[model samples]
Target: MATTALFFLFAGFAIACAVSMVYHRNPLYSAISLVGVFIALSCIYITLAAPFIAAVQILIYAGAIMVLVVFVIMLLNLEDDKPLNRLRYLYAVGGGLGLILLVQTFFIFYAVMRAPKQTVDADVTVGKTLSIGTAMYTEYLLPVEIVGILLLMAVIGGVILARRLEQPKLELVVDNELERRGEGEIKDEFRIRL
Candidate 1:
Protein backbone atom coordinates (compact mmCIF):
# COMPACT_ATOMS: atom_id res chain seq x y z
CA MET A 1 0.00 0.00 0.00
CA ALA A 2 2.75 2.41 0.84
CA THR A 3 4.63 1.55 -2.34
CA THR A 4 1.51 2.01 -4.40
CA ALA A 5 0.89 5.38 -2.76
CA LEU A 6 4.46 6.45 -3.40
CA PHE A 7 4.20 5.38 -7.03
CA PHE A 8 1.03 7.43 -7.49
CA LEU A 9 2.68 10.43 -5.80
CA PHE A 10 5.71 10.31 -8.08
CA ALA A 11 3.57 9.69 -11.14
CA GLY A 12 1.39 12.68 -10.37
CA PHE A 13 4.42 14.85 -9.74
CA ALA A 14 5.91 13.75 -13.06
CA ILE A 15 2.72 14.61 -14.89
CA ALA A 16 2.51 18.02 -13.24
CA CYS A 17 6.13 18.76 -14.06
CA ALA A 18 5.62 17.70 -17.67
CA VAL A 19 2.62 20.01 -17.91
CA SER A 20 4.62 22.86 -16.42
CA MET A 21 7.45 22.20 -18.85
CA VAL A 22 5.05 22.50 -21.75
CA TYR A 23 3.07 25.49 -20.45
CA HIS A 24 5.83 27.67 -19.05
CA ARG A 25 6.62 30.70 -21.25
CA ASN A 26 10.18 31.13 -20.13
CA PRO A 27 12.58 28.59 -21.62
CA LEU A 28 14.62 28.38 -18.40
CA TYR A 29 11.47 27.66 -16.40
CA SER A 30 10.45 25.00 -18.91
CA ALA A 31 13.90 23.39 -18.68
CA ILE A 32 13.75 23.41 -14.89
CA SER A 33 10.31 21.81 -15.00
CA LEU A 34 11.67 19.18 -17.37
CA VAL A 35 14.42 18.45 -14.85
CA GLY A 36 11.72 17.98 -12.24
CA VAL A 37 9.97 15.57 -14.58
CA PHE A 38 13.22 13.65 -15.01
CA ILE A 39 13.66 13.41 -11.23
CA ALA A 40 10.11 12.16 -10.81
CA LEU A 41 10.68 9.60 -13.52
CA SER A 42 13.86 8.47 -11.74
CA CYS A 43 11.80 8.01 -8.58
CA ILE A 44 9.25 5.95 -10.49
CA TYR A 45 12.03 3.81 -11.95
CA ILE A 46 13.41 3.25 -8.46
CA THR A 47 9.95 2.09 -7.30
CA LEU A 48 9.91 -0.39 -10.20
CA ALA A 49 13.00 -2.17 -8.74
CA ALA A 50 15.26 -0.89 -11.48
CA PRO A 51 17.88 0.99 -9.53
CA PHE A 52 20.32 0.93 -12.43
CA ILE A 53 17.76 2.50 -14.74
CA ALA A 54 16.87 5.07 -12.06
CA ALA A 55 20.51 6.00 -11.61
CA VAL A 56 21.00 6.30 -15.36
CA GLN A 57 17.84 8.39 -15.65
CA ILE A 58 19.11 10.74 -12.98
CA LEU A 59 22.68 10.85 -14.30
CA ILE A 60 22.07 10.91 -18.05
CA TYR A 61 18.74 12.63 -18.61
CA ALA A 62 18.57 14.77 -15.47
CA GLY A 63 22.27 15.55 -15.28
CA ALA A 64 23.91 15.59 -18.73
CA ILE A 65 20.99 16.15 -21.08
CA MET A 66 19.37 18.84 -18.95
CA VAL A 67 22.67 20.63 -18.53
CA LEU A 68 23.09 20.61 -22.31
CA VAL A 69 19.53 21.89 -22.80
CA VAL A 70 20.01 24.66 -20.28
CA PHE A 71 23.35 25.57 -21.84
CA VAL A 72 21.69 25.77 -25.28
CA ILE A 73 18.90 27.89 -23.86
CA MET A 74 21.41 30.27 -22.34
CA LEU A 75 23.51 30.33 -25.51
CA LEU A 76 20.54 31.14 -27.72
CA ASN A 77 19.03 33.71 -25.32
CA LEU A 78 15.56 33.12 -26.68
CA GLU A 79 12.46 35.20 -26.00
CA ASP A 80 8.76 34.40 -26.19
CA ASP A 81 7.79 35.10 -29.77
CA LYS A 82 4.14 34.18 -30.12
CA PRO A 83 1.35 35.72 -28.06
CA LEU A 84 -0.95 33.48 -25.96
CA ASN A 85 -3.91 34.25 -28.18
CA ARG A 86 -2.02 33.00 -31.24
CA LEU A 87 -1.59 29.56 -29.66
CA ARG A 88 -5.15 29.17 -28.40
CA TYR A 89 -5.94 26.47 -30.94
CA LEU A 90 -2.79 24.54 -30.04
CA TYR A 91 -3.69 24.78 -26.37
CA ALA A 92 -7.20 23.50 -27.07
CA VAL A 93 -5.88 20.49 -29.00
CA GLY A 94 -3.30 19.74 -26.30
CA GLY A 95 -5.93 19.97 -23.60
CA GLY A 96 -8.19 17.59 -25.47
CA LEU A 97 -5.36 15.08 -25.87
CA GLY A 98 -4.42 15.41 -22.20
CA LEU A 99 -8.05 14.73 -21.18
CA ILE A 100 -8.15 11.62 -23.33
CA LEU A 101 -4.85 10.39 -21.90
CA LEU A 102 -6.07 11.00 -18.34
CA VAL A 103 -9.22 9.00 -18.98
CA GLN A 104 -7.22 6.14 -20.50
CA THR A 105 -4.79 6.13 -17.58
CA PHE A 106 -7.68 6.03 -15.11
CA PHE A 107 -9.22 3.00 -16.81
CA ILE A 108 -5.85 1.26 -17.07
CA PHE A 109 -5.13 1.77 -13.38
CA TYR A 110 -8.59 0.53 -12.46
CA ALA A 111 -8.12 -2.62 -14.53
CA VAL A 112 -4.69 -3.21 -13.01
CA MET A 113 -6.09 -2.88 -9.52
CA ARG A 114 -8.81 -5.42 -10.32
CA ALA A 115 -6.34 -7.96 -11.72
CA PRO A 116 -4.81 -10.74 -9.65
CA LYS A 117 -1.25 -10.28 -8.47
CA GLN A 118 1.40 -12.48 -10.06
CA THR A 119 4.71 -13.66 -8.66
CA VAL A 120 7.84 -12.13 -10.16
CA ASP A 121 10.41 -14.52 -11.59
CA ALA A 122 13.44 -14.79 -9.33
CA ASP A 123 15.68 -15.81 -12.25
CA VAL A 124 15.01 -12.61 -14.17
CA THR A 125 18.11 -10.46 -14.49
CA VAL A 126 16.64 -7.94 -16.93
CA GLY A 127 17.22 -4.74 -15.00
CA LYS A 128 20.75 -5.51 -13.84
CA THR A 129 23.50 -3.21 -15.23
CA LEU A 130 25.80 -6.13 -15.95
CA SER A 131 23.19 -7.94 -18.00
CA ILE A 132 22.27 -4.76 -19.81
CA GLY A 133 25.91 -3.97 -20.57
CA THR A 134 26.50 -7.49 -21.83
CA ALA A 135 23.49 -7.28 -24.10
CA MET A 136 24.53 -3.85 -25.40
CA TYR A 137 28.06 -4.93 -26.18
CA THR A 138 27.03 -8.25 -27.71
CA GLU A 139 23.73 -7.63 -29.42
CA TYR A 140 23.55 -3.85 -29.96
CA LEU A 141 27.17 -2.91 -30.42
CA LEU A 142 26.86 -1.71 -34.01
CA PRO A 143 23.91 0.57 -33.30
CA VAL A 144 25.62 1.95 -30.22
CA GLU A 145 28.80 2.65 -32.19
CA ILE A 146 26.75 4.28 -34.94
CA VAL A 147 25.05 6.55 -32.43
CA GLY A 148 28.40 7.48 -30.90
CA ILE A 149 29.81 8.34 -34.32
CA LEU A 150 26.72 10.41 -35.11
CA LEU A 151 27.12 12.34 -31.88
CA LEU A 152 30.78 12.98 -32.69
CA MET A 153 29.86 14.24 -36.14
CA ALA A 154 27.17 16.48 -34.65
CA VAL A 155 29.69 18.00 -32.26
CA ILE A 156 32.10 18.64 -35.09
CA GLY A 157 29.32 20.18 -37.18
CA GLY A 158 28.29 22.42 -34.31
CA VAL A 159 31.84 23.65 -33.90
CA ILE A 160 32.19 24.34 -37.61
CA LEU A 161 28.87 26.19 -37.74
CA ALA A 162 29.63 28.31 -34.69
CA ARG A 163 32.99 29.48 -36.00
CA ARG A 164 33.05 33.24 -36.70
CA LEU A 165 34.00 34.50 -40.14
CA GLU A 166 36.73 37.11 -40.47
CA GLN A 167 35.73 40.36 -42.15
CA PRO A 168 37.82 43.29 -43.34
CA LYS A 169 37.78 46.36 -41.10
CA LEU A 170 36.33 49.69 -42.24
CA GLU A 171 38.46 52.81 -42.18
CA LEU A 172 37.34 56.47 -42.21
CA VAL A 173 39.41 58.85 -44.36
CA VAL A 174 39.34 62.66 -44.22
CA ASP A 175 40.70 64.96 -46.96
CA ASN A 176 43.40 67.42 -45.85
CA GLU A 177 41.85 70.10 -48.11
CA LEU A 178 38.51 69.58 -46.46
CA GLU A 179 40.14 69.90 -43.05
CA ARG A 180 41.82 73.21 -44.08
CA ARG A 181 38.45 74.52 -45.37
CA GLY A 182 36.82 73.67 -42.03
CA GLU A 183 34.71 70.97 -43.72
CA GLY A 184 36.50 67.91 -42.32
CA GLU A 185 33.44 65.64 -42.45
CA ILE A 186 34.47 62.35 -44.12
CA LYS A 187 31.28 62.06 -46.26
CA ASP A 188 31.47 59.00 -48.56
CA GLU A 189 35.14 58.66 -47.70
CA PHE A 190 34.87 55.45 -45.69
CA ARG A 191 36.50 52.35 -47.25
CA ILE A 192 37.52 48.89 -46.15
CA ARG A 193 40.91 48.87 -44.55
CA LEU A 194 42.73 46.01 -46.18
Candidate 2:
Protein backbone atom coordinates (compact mmCIF):
# COMPACT_ATOMS: atom_id res chain seq x y z
CA MET A 1 0.00 0.00 0.00
CA ALA A 2 2.80 2.38 0.93
CA THR A 3 4.69 1.53 -2.23
CA THR A 4 1.60 2.07 -4.33
CA ALA A 5 0.98 5.41 -2.62
CA LEU A 6 4.56 6.51 -3.19
CA PHE A 7 4.39 5.41 -6.84
CA PHE A 8 1.19 7.43 -7.36
CA LEU A 9 2.70 10.45 -5.63
CA PHE A 10 5.83 10.35 -7.78
CA ALA A 11 3.78 9.72 -10.92
CA GLY A 12 1.58 12.73 -10.19
CA PHE A 13 4.58 14.93 -9.52
CA ALA A 14 6.22 13.73 -12.73
CA ILE A 15 3.11 14.51 -14.73
CA ALA A 16 2.80 17.99 -13.19
CA CYS A 17 6.45 18.76 -13.82
CA ALA A 18 6.18 17.50 -17.43
CA VAL A 19 3.16 19.74 -17.99
CA SER A 20 5.01 22.69 -16.51
CA MET A 21 8.04 21.93 -18.65
CA VAL A 22 5.89 22.07 -21.78
CA TYR A 23 3.85 25.14 -20.78
CA HIS A 24 6.59 27.41 -19.37
CA ARG A 25 7.55 30.23 -21.69
CA ASN A 26 11.04 30.56 -20.24
CA PRO A 27 13.55 27.97 -21.49
CA LEU A 28 15.45 27.92 -18.21
CA TYR A 29 12.26 27.35 -16.23
CA SER A 30 11.21 24.62 -18.64
CA ALA A 31 14.60 22.90 -18.28
CA ILE A 32 14.36 23.10 -14.51
CA SER A 33 10.90 21.59 -14.64
CA LEU A 34 12.27 18.83 -16.88
CA VAL A 35 14.84 18.05 -14.19
CA GLY A 36 12.02 17.74 -11.68
CA VAL A 37 10.23 15.41 -14.09
CA PHE A 38 13.37 13.31 -14.49
CA ILE A 39 13.82 13.07 -10.74
CA ALA A 40 10.22 12.02 -10.31
CA LEU A 41 10.67 9.41 -13.08
CA SER A 42 13.77 8.10 -11.32
CA CYS A 43 11.75 7.73 -8.13
CA ILE A 44 9.10 5.83 -10.05
CA TYR A 45 11.76 3.56 -11.55
CA ILE A 46 13.11 2.86 -8.04
CA THR A 47 9.64 1.96 -6.83
CA LEU A 48 9.31 -0.43 -9.77
CA ALA A 49 12.47 -2.22 -8.51
CA ALA A 50 14.53 -1.22 -11.53
CA PRO A 51 17.37 0.40 -9.60
CA PHE A 52 19.74 0.31 -12.58
CA ILE A 53 17.28 2.24 -14.73
CA ALA A 54 16.67 4.63 -11.82
CA ALA A 55 20.41 5.26 -11.46
CA VAL A 56 20.76 5.78 -15.21
CA GLN A 57 17.81 8.16 -15.12
CA ILE A 58 19.53 10.21 -12.41
CA LEU A 59 23.03 10.05 -13.87
CA ILE A 60 22.25 10.40 -17.56
CA TYR A 61 18.91 12.19 -17.91
CA ALA A 62 18.79 14.23 -14.68
CA GLY A 63 22.49 14.99 -14.40
CA ALA A 64 24.25 14.87 -17.78
CA ILE A 65 21.36 15.67 -20.13
CA MET A 66 20.03 18.46 -17.89
CA VAL A 67 23.50 19.98 -17.63
CA LEU A 68 23.84 19.91 -21.42
CA VAL A 69 20.38 21.51 -21.81
CA VAL A 70 21.22 24.23 -19.29
CA PHE A 71 24.58 24.88 -20.92
CA VAL A 72 22.92 25.21 -24.35
CA ILE A 73 20.26 27.49 -22.89
CA MET A 74 22.93 29.69 -21.33
CA LEU A 75 25.01 29.70 -24.51
CA LEU A 76 22.01 30.61 -26.63
CA ASN A 77 21.04 33.39 -24.16
CA LEU A 78 17.33 32.93 -24.88
CA GLU A 79 14.88 35.72 -24.10
CA ASP A 80 11.41 35.30 -22.59
CA ASP A 81 8.86 34.42 -25.24
CA LYS A 82 6.00 36.65 -26.33
CA PRO A 83 2.59 36.58 -24.61
CA LEU A 84 0.34 33.59 -25.38
CA ASN A 85 -2.48 35.89 -26.42
CA ARG A 86 -1.24 35.63 -29.99
CA LEU A 87 -1.43 31.85 -29.71
CA ARG A 88 -4.65 31.54 -27.74
CA TYR A 89 -5.98 28.99 -30.21
CA LEU A 90 -2.86 26.89 -29.78
CA TYR A 91 -3.45 26.96 -26.03
CA ALA A 92 -6.98 25.66 -26.55
CA VAL A 93 -5.69 22.85 -28.73
CA GLY A 94 -2.97 21.97 -26.22
CA GLY A 95 -5.50 21.97 -23.37
CA GLY A 96 -7.79 19.62 -25.30
CA LEU A 97 -4.88 17.26 -26.08
CA GLY A 98 -3.80 17.38 -22.46
CA LEU A 99 -7.31 16.41 -21.35
CA ILE A 100 -7.33 13.45 -23.76
CA LEU A 101 -3.91 12.28 -22.53
CA LEU A 102 -5.03 12.59 -18.90
CA VAL A 103 -8.05 10.42 -19.54
CA GLN A 104 -5.92 7.81 -21.34
CA THR A 105 -3.38 7.79 -18.52
CA PHE A 106 -6.08 7.31 -15.91
CA PHE A 107 -7.51 4.35 -17.78
CA ILE A 108 -4.06 2.83 -18.28
CA PHE A 109 -3.13 3.25 -14.62
CA TYR A 110 -6.42 1.76 -13.49
CA ALA A 111 -5.91 -1.26 -15.74
CA VAL A 112 -2.35 -1.73 -14.50
CA MET A 113 -3.42 -1.48 -10.87
CA ARG A 114 -6.10 -4.08 -11.31
CA ALA A 115 -3.88 -6.58 -13.17
CA PRO A 116 -2.51 -9.61 -11.41
CA LYS A 117 1.10 -9.29 -10.34
CA GLN A 118 3.46 -12.05 -11.36
CA THR A 119 6.75 -13.01 -9.71
CA VAL A 120 9.77 -14.10 -11.72
CA ASP A 121 12.93 -15.79 -10.49
CA ALA A 122 15.63 -13.16 -10.49
CA ASP A 123 18.46 -13.92 -12.89
CA VAL A 124 21.98 -12.87 -11.94
CA THR A 125 22.81 -11.60 -15.44
CA VAL A 126 19.46 -9.99 -16.21
CA GLY A 127 20.04 -6.39 -15.06
CA LYS A 128 23.81 -6.35 -14.82
CA THR A 129 25.54 -3.55 -16.73
CA LEU A 130 28.22 -5.93 -17.99
CA SER A 131 25.67 -8.38 -19.40
CA ILE A 132 23.82 -5.57 -21.13
CA GLY A 133 27.06 -4.28 -22.66
CA THR A 134 27.98 -7.78 -23.81
CA ALA A 135 24.58 -8.31 -25.37
CA MET A 136 24.74 -4.96 -27.17
CA TYR A 137 28.19 -5.62 -28.58
CA THR A 138 27.50 -9.23 -29.55
CA GLU A 139 23.83 -9.66 -30.41
CA TYR A 140 23.03 -6.08 -31.40
CA LEU A 141 26.34 -5.26 -33.06
CA LEU A 142 24.97 -4.73 -36.59
CA PRO A 143 22.18 -2.42 -35.46
CA VAL A 144 24.58 -0.53 -33.23
CA GLU A 145 27.02 -0.08 -36.14
CA ILE A 146 24.18 1.10 -38.37
CA VAL A 147 23.07 3.62 -35.78
CA GLY A 148 26.65 4.86 -35.40
CA ILE A 149 26.92 5.32 -39.17
CA LEU A 150 23.62 7.18 -39.22
CA LEU A 151 24.80 9.47 -36.43
CA LEU A 152 28.06 10.10 -38.27
CA MET A 153 26.16 11.02 -41.42
CA ALA A 154 23.92 13.33 -39.40
CA VAL A 155 26.94 15.03 -37.83
CA ILE A 156 28.53 15.49 -41.24
CA GLY A 157 25.31 16.89 -42.63
CA GLY A 158 24.95 19.28 -39.70
CA VAL A 159 28.51 20.51 -40.11
CA ILE A 160 28.02 20.99 -43.83
CA LEU A 161 24.77 22.88 -43.26
CA ALA A 162 26.20 25.08 -40.50
CA ARG A 163 29.35 26.11 -42.39
CA ARG A 164 29.33 29.66 -43.75
CA LEU A 165 30.34 30.26 -47.35
CA GLU A 166 32.66 33.18 -48.03
CA GLN A 167 31.19 35.87 -50.27
CA PRO A 168 33.43 37.19 -53.13
CA LYS A 169 34.52 40.79 -52.63
CA LEU A 170 33.90 43.36 -55.40
CA GLU A 171 36.55 46.00 -56.08
CA LEU A 172 36.38 48.86 -58.60
CA VAL A 173 39.59 50.58 -59.81
CA VAL A 174 39.00 53.98 -61.47
CA ASP A 175 41.39 55.92 -63.70
CA ASN A 176 42.73 59.37 -62.63
CA GLU A 177 40.12 61.11 -64.87
CA LEU A 178 37.26 59.09 -63.41
CA GLU A 179 38.59 59.69 -59.87
CA ARG A 180 38.49 63.46 -60.42
CA ARG A 181 34.95 63.34 -61.89
CA GLY A 182 32.01 64.39 -59.64
CA GLU A 183 29.00 62.11 -59.00
CA GLY A 184 26.69 64.43 -61.08
CA GLU A 185 29.16 64.38 -64.04
CA ILE A 186 29.39 60.55 -63.88
CA LYS A 187 25.58 60.27 -63.87
CA ASP A 188 25.38 62.69 -66.85
CA GLU A 189 27.98 60.60 -68.77
CA PHE A 190 26.06 57.30 -68.02
CA ARG A 191 22.72 58.96 -69.00
CA ILE A 192 24.22 60.16 -72.35
CA ARG A 193 25.60 56.61 -73.04
CA LEU A 194 22.18 55.13 -72.25
Candidate 3:
Protein backbone atom coordinates (compact mmCIF):
# COMPACT_ATOMS: atom_id res chain seq x y z
CA MET A 1 0.00 0.00 0.00
CA ALA A 2 2.77 2.39 0.91
CA THR A 3 4.66 1.52 -2.27
CA THR A 4 1.60 2.18 -4.40
CA ALA A 5 1.06 5.51 -2.63
CA LEU A 6 4.68 6.50 -3.18
CA PHE A 7 4.44 5.54 -6.83
CA PHE A 8 1.38 7.74 -7.36
CA LEU A 9 3.04 10.59 -5.43
CA PHE A 10 6.14 10.54 -7.55
CA ALA A 11 4.19 10.02 -10.74
CA GLY A 12 2.03 13.05 -9.97
CA PHE A 13 5.12 15.09 -9.13
CA ALA A 14 6.77 13.98 -12.37
CA ILE A 15 3.72 15.06 -14.38
CA ALA A 16 3.65 18.41 -12.60
CA CYS A 17 7.34 18.99 -13.22
CA ALA A 18 6.96 18.05 -16.89
CA VAL A 19 4.22 20.65 -17.22
CA SER A 20 6.36 23.20 -15.41
CA MET A 21 9.28 22.43 -17.69
CA VAL A 22 7.14 23.08 -20.73
CA TYR A 23 5.49 26.16 -19.24
CA HIS A 24 8.67 27.98 -18.18
CA ARG A 25 10.02 30.66 -20.56
CA ASN A 26 13.61 30.50 -19.29
CA PRO A 27 15.72 27.57 -20.58
CA LEU A 28 17.56 27.18 -17.29
CA TYR A 29 14.29 26.96 -15.33
CA SER A 30 12.98 24.43 -17.85
CA ALA A 31 16.17 22.39 -17.48
CA ILE A 32 15.84 22.52 -13.68
CA SER A 33 12.23 21.40 -13.95
CA LEU A 34 13.29 18.58 -16.25
CA VAL A 35 15.80 17.46 -13.57
CA GLY A 36 12.95 17.47 -11.05
CA VAL A 37 10.90 15.37 -13.45
CA PHE A 38 13.80 12.94 -13.86
CA ILE A 39 14.21 12.56 -10.08
CA ALA A 40 10.49 12.03 -9.63
CA LEU A 41 10.56 9.38 -12.36
CA SER A 42 13.52 7.70 -10.60
CA CYS A 43 11.47 7.57 -7.38
CA ILE A 44 8.53 6.10 -9.31
CA TYR A 45 10.80 3.42 -10.80
CA ILE A 46 11.96 2.52 -7.27
CA THR A 47 8.35 2.16 -6.07
CA LEU A 48 7.63 -0.15 -9.05
CA ALA A 49 10.37 -2.57 -7.91
CA ALA A 50 12.82 -1.59 -10.63
CA PRO A 51 15.90 -0.43 -8.74
CA PHE A 52 18.19 -0.83 -11.75
CA ILE A 53 15.99 1.41 -13.91
CA ALA A 54 15.75 3.90 -11.04
CA ALA A 55 19.52 3.97 -10.70
CA VAL A 56 19.90 4.49 -14.45
CA GLN A 57 17.25 7.18 -14.35
CA ILE A 58 19.22 9.05 -11.69
CA LEU A 59 22.73 8.33 -12.97
CA ILE A 60 22.23 8.67 -16.72
CA TYR A 61 19.20 10.93 -17.22
CA ALA A 62 19.25 13.07 -14.08
CA GLY A 63 22.97 13.19 -13.36
CA ALA A 64 24.83 12.98 -16.67
CA ILE A 65 22.28 14.16 -19.26
CA MET A 66 20.92 17.01 -17.14
CA VAL A 67 24.44 18.17 -16.31
CA LEU A 68 25.24 18.31 -20.04
CA VAL A 69 22.00 20.15 -20.80
CA VAL A 70 22.51 22.69 -18.02
CA PHE A 71 26.16 23.16 -19.01
CA VAL A 72 25.17 23.90 -22.63
CA ILE A 73 22.46 26.31 -21.49
CA MET A 74 24.97 28.16 -19.28
CA LEU A 75 27.58 28.12 -22.02
CA LEU A 76 25.16 29.67 -24.49
CA ASN A 77 24.18 32.32 -21.89
CA LEU A 78 20.50 32.08 -22.82
CA GLU A 79 17.90 34.67 -21.89
CA ASP A 80 14.11 34.52 -21.50
CA ASP A 81 12.58 34.32 -24.99
CA LYS A 82 10.28 37.10 -26.04
CA PRO A 83 6.78 35.90 -26.85
CA LEU A 84 5.77 36.59 -30.44
CA ASN A 85 2.25 37.75 -31.31
CA ARG A 86 2.21 36.13 -34.78
CA LEU A 87 2.67 32.65 -33.22
CA ARG A 88 -0.83 32.72 -31.72
CA TYR A 89 -2.13 30.58 -34.58
CA LEU A 90 0.61 28.04 -33.95
CA TYR A 91 -0.31 28.03 -30.26
CA ALA A 92 -3.93 27.36 -31.17
CA VAL A 93 -2.95 24.48 -33.42
CA GLY A 94 -0.75 23.01 -30.71
CA GLY A 95 -3.59 23.32 -28.18
CA GLY A 96 -5.91 21.50 -30.55
CA LEU A 97 -3.34 18.74 -30.98
CA GLY A 98 -2.90 18.53 -27.21
CA LEU A 99 -6.65 18.22 -26.73
CA ILE A 100 -6.73 15.36 -29.20
CA LEU A 101 -3.90 13.66 -27.35
CA LEU A 102 -5.71 14.06 -24.00
CA VAL A 103 -8.83 12.42 -25.40
CA GLN A 104 -6.77 9.62 -26.93
CA THR A 105 -4.98 9.11 -23.61
CA PHE A 106 -8.31 8.76 -21.81
CA PHE A 107 -9.54 6.21 -24.32
CA ILE A 108 -6.31 4.23 -24.02
CA PHE A 109 -6.55 4.27 -20.24
CA TYR A 110 -10.10 2.99 -20.36
CA ALA A 111 -9.12 0.21 -22.73
CA VAL A 112 -6.13 -0.74 -20.57
CA MET A 113 -8.25 -0.85 -17.39
CA ARG A 114 -10.63 -3.38 -18.98
CA ALA A 115 -7.86 -5.48 -20.63
CA PRO A 116 -7.23 -9.15 -19.78
CA LYS A 117 -4.43 -10.32 -17.48
CA GLN A 118 -0.92 -10.89 -18.77
CA THR A 119 -0.28 -14.08 -20.77
CA VAL A 120 3.45 -13.99 -19.95
CA ASP A 121 5.00 -15.40 -16.77
CA ALA A 122 4.92 -13.24 -13.63
CA ASP A 123 8.42 -14.38 -12.54
CA VAL A 124 10.07 -13.38 -15.84
CA THR A 125 13.80 -12.49 -15.86
CA VAL A 126 13.46 -10.12 -18.84
CA GLY A 127 13.38 -7.07 -16.55
CA LYS A 128 16.27 -8.14 -14.34
CA THR A 129 19.57 -6.22 -14.75
CA LEU A 130 21.73 -9.35 -14.87
CA SER A 131 19.58 -10.94 -17.55
CA ILE A 132 19.49 -7.70 -19.55
CA GLY A 133 23.29 -7.29 -19.28
CA THR A 134 23.83 -10.89 -20.35
CA ALA A 135 21.49 -10.47 -23.31
CA MET A 136 23.29 -7.25 -24.35
CA TYR A 137 26.68 -9.02 -24.26
CA THR A 138 25.46 -12.19 -25.99
CA GLU A 139 22.77 -11.16 -28.48
CA TYR A 140 23.04 -7.36 -28.92
CA LEU A 141 26.83 -7.12 -28.72
CA LEU A 142 27.37 -5.87 -32.27
CA PRO A 143 24.78 -3.13 -32.03
CA VAL A 144 26.13 -2.02 -28.64
CA GLU A 145 29.69 -1.89 -30.02
CA ILE A 146 28.53 0.11 -33.03
CA VAL A 147 26.76 2.61 -30.74
CA GLY A 148 29.87 2.95 -28.57
CA ILE A 149 32.02 3.68 -31.62
CA LEU A 150 29.52 6.28 -32.84
CA LEU A 151 29.55 7.97 -29.41
CA LEU A 152 33.39 8.02 -29.45
CA MET A 153 33.34 9.64 -32.88
CA ALA A 154 30.83 12.22 -31.68
CA VAL A 155 33.00 13.10 -28.67
CA ILE A 156 36.10 13.52 -30.88
CA GLY A 157 34.17 15.75 -33.28
CA GLY A 158 32.85 17.84 -30.39
CA VAL A 159 36.42 18.36 -29.08
CA ILE A 160 37.62 19.46 -32.51
CA LEU A 161 34.71 21.89 -32.90
CA ALA A 162 35.27 23.35 -29.40
CA ARG A 163 38.97 23.94 -30.13
CA ARG A 164 38.18 25.56 -33.48
CA LEU A 165 35.65 27.85 -31.79
CA GLU A 166 38.25 29.00 -29.22
CA GLN A 167 40.79 30.23 -31.77
CA PRO A 168 43.06 32.97 -30.34
CA LYS A 169 42.84 36.49 -31.76
CA LEU A 170 45.97 38.58 -32.02
CA GLU A 171 45.90 42.14 -30.56
CA LEU A 172 48.36 44.92 -31.30
CA VAL A 173 50.22 46.16 -28.19
CA VAL A 174 52.46 48.66 -29.95
CA ASP A 175 55.00 50.56 -27.85
CA ASN A 176 55.14 54.31 -28.67
CA GLU A 177 58.94 54.26 -28.54
CA LEU A 178 59.25 51.07 -30.74
CA GLU A 179 60.23 51.31 -34.44
CA ARG A 180 58.34 49.91 -37.50
CA ARG A 181 58.50 46.21 -38.60
CA GLY A 182 58.50 45.09 -34.91
CA GLU A 183 56.98 41.55 -34.50
CA GLY A 184 56.86 41.68 -30.63
CA GLU A 185 53.92 44.15 -30.63
CA ILE A 186 51.30 41.41 -31.33
CA LYS A 187 49.86 39.75 -28.19
CA ASP A 188 48.03 36.41 -28.52
CA GLU A 189 47.78 35.63 -24.81
CA PHE A 190 44.49 37.28 -23.86
CA ARG A 191 41.44 35.71 -25.58
CA ILE A 192 38.18 37.68 -25.42
CA ARG A 193 35.22 35.73 -26.84
CA LEU A 194 31.88 37.46 -26.45
Q: Which candidate is the best by TM-score?
A: 3
**Candidate 1 vs. true structure, TM-score:** 0.67
- TM-score per candidate, chains pooled: 0.67, 0.65, 0.74
> In lDDT terms, how accurate is model 1?
0.84
- Runs in model 3 lying further than 4 Å from the true structure: 119-125, 165-194
Q: Rate the local accuracy (lDDT) of all candidates.
A: 0.84, 0.81, 0.81
Query: Which residue pairs does candidate 2 place in steric collision?
Result: none
Q: What tens-digit string does per-residue lDDT give for candidate 2 at 1-194?
A: 99999999999999899889977999999999999999999898777666777898899998897998999999999998777667679978988998998899999999999999977544543445666678889999999999999999998998999887543222122333455665544633433210
Which regions of candidate 1 deviate over 4 angstroms? Answer: 72-82, 87-118, 165-194
Candidate 1 RMSD to the correct structure: 7.3
In model 2, the runs with Cα more than 4 Å from the true position are 5-9, 122-127, 165-194
Worst 10 residues of 1 by lDDT: 167-176
Q: Cα RMSD to native, each candidate?
A: 7.3, 8.5, 5.7
lDDT of 1 by residue, 1-194 (tens): 99899999999999999989887889999999999999999898777777788999899998999999999999999896455766679978988998999999999999999999987653364666877889889999999999999999999999999987564333323344556767666543643445
Give the number of the best model, judged by lDDT: 1
Q: How far is candidate 2 from the true structure (C-alpha RMSD, Å)?
A: 8.5
